[model samples]
Target chain A: MSETNELKVREKQEVAPSAELTKPGPVFTPHVDIFETDNSLTLLVDMPGVKADDLNVDLRDDILTLTGDAKPSLATPGEKIYGEYETGRYYRQFSLSEVIAQDKIDAKLSDGVLRLTLPKVEKATPRRIMVQVD
Target chain B: MIYRTLFGAPGRRFGASLKELEEMQQRMDRLFNGFRDRSAGRVGVGAGVFPAINISEDTGAYYVSAELPGVTSADLEINVTANQLTLAGERKISKEAADARYHRREREAGRFSRALALPGDIDADNVKAGLADGVLTITIPKAEKAKPRQITVQ
Candidate 1:
């Protein structure tokens, strides 16, 4: 096994209890990766076992909240011998900056990963103005 | 924390006293394991956590599920031996532009391999595996000799 390429297993981070729970189970904060380009900011969120219809993405007053309900996959419950992780809903929030065009944001979910693209406003995009010499 | 065998067996749900004991045992296990995890200096860092798994069994088969967000069927490889099941896969995150600046990066991309010792002999020919929503579920049927048989009382 290559030491550098080995996958490091991290336990899921549970959402803080300070957040009010709308549902009855443990909620976890999904891991996320955010990057910004010249035109837009992209967020990749990992929420395994969540279906597209069960996910809710809400944005208001520069606060973006993501909630996904992940149902148990087993149709028939069996004797659980060993479990490393528990099934729960995923919840997280991020406050956006003024430069982001909230209305123009786009979201897509595929294979348990949610990708959000927030386009920058025209004023915030970098533009090079050519100097004219008469 | 390392995984532990859950207390209480099938059909024990009606035993309230046993159920309470199970819950108490679970709480105590967590309390002590939390200390062990911290002392090992692996708390929060998750030194060996990857593709978290859950193993369970019914009368006829054993089931194993792994959480592998963002991984597709094309990147996974599954192999089962007489007493072991091996999962090997690679996760790839699309590359962004050269000028892209990362605000936070927690998702990872790489190859990972894990081999588990199955509890009983597996009917390798009939094992079923499927990947959906980035989670992989493997259904391993127990071998004929390993499966429980109901013997009539003579």
Candidate 2:
């Protein structure tokens, strides 16, 4: 209820991609903040270099997959002095429960953070039952 | 135009504290050990993760980008000396819910400082810092003498 954008941040599970193929570069599992409200679940993922055009979020057979390529700004005109960080792609996926209204999922990206909203079904939300007079 | 500083001996590296030095050593080990666990996409060490940075330079400026997923611009501070750049920041734990429990906890929250010696003089006046998503980018313009110049032979 405290979420203003209708995205209640909650707890969710995620794992990195496990494809056997050799990825050209390092693939990072983005850090995410998942929240849930009475009606929906929201996920806030950190993907700094990933742009809107390069991002892909997919849902298939109750599995939600997220993959994106971050264009490395590591390229510079001057000779290399030093490097300490690794740059590559961002990928993560999560499984949705049956109570989730998967079709109404929404995703938005801003300032490198991806916010995803997955609404819950009407049966999943709590409703107060009225007491009958005896 | 000075390449010596690139290999300059650490006549002193920003006076690291005891705790910072320990963290720095762990980072070096992580690099050498090549603990790139394909499954977790991270080193198994919980508290040994150092916010790695890439520092590079062009004709005009020196650029530095640090990987800081949860850190915001307001939580960070950037300082530029004659030949040093220091980035200080803190990552805080979200306290929105008190009943939440983490299944697999890897990320941590704490203060971090990365002090790097610049390869050249900094313009100081035109230094720009920006935070996009979770990455902090700092562009420090090279001093007048450091900018590459082409001279003609007549």
Off by over 4 Å in 2: A1-23, A35-38, A73-77, A124-134, B1-50, B97-106, B149-151
**Interface RMSD for candidate number 2?**
9.2
lDDT of candidate 1 over A16-127, digit per residue (tens): 6675766677788999999998889899999988989889988888888899888875322478777677778898989988477778989999888999998988774587
lDDT of 2 at A8: 17
lDDT of 2 by residue, B1-154 (tens): 3666654444444444556889999999877666444343443322232556666777889887766766778878888889898877776545645543333334456777767788788898788988875677788899999988999998
Residue B100 error, candidate 1, Å: 1.2
Docking class of 1: acceptable
Instruction: Give the distance in Å from residue B1's predicted Cα in candidate 2 to where it truly belongs.
Output: 55
Give the candidate number with the greatest DockQ.
1
**How far off is each candidate at the interface, as Cα RMSD in Å?**
4.0, 9.2
Q: State candidate 2's TM-score.
A: 0.65
- What is the lDDT of every predicted structure here? 0.82, 0.68
* Cα lDDT of model 2 by residue, A49-118, tens digit: 7878889988888888888778765333364455554567888888876466767988988666777788
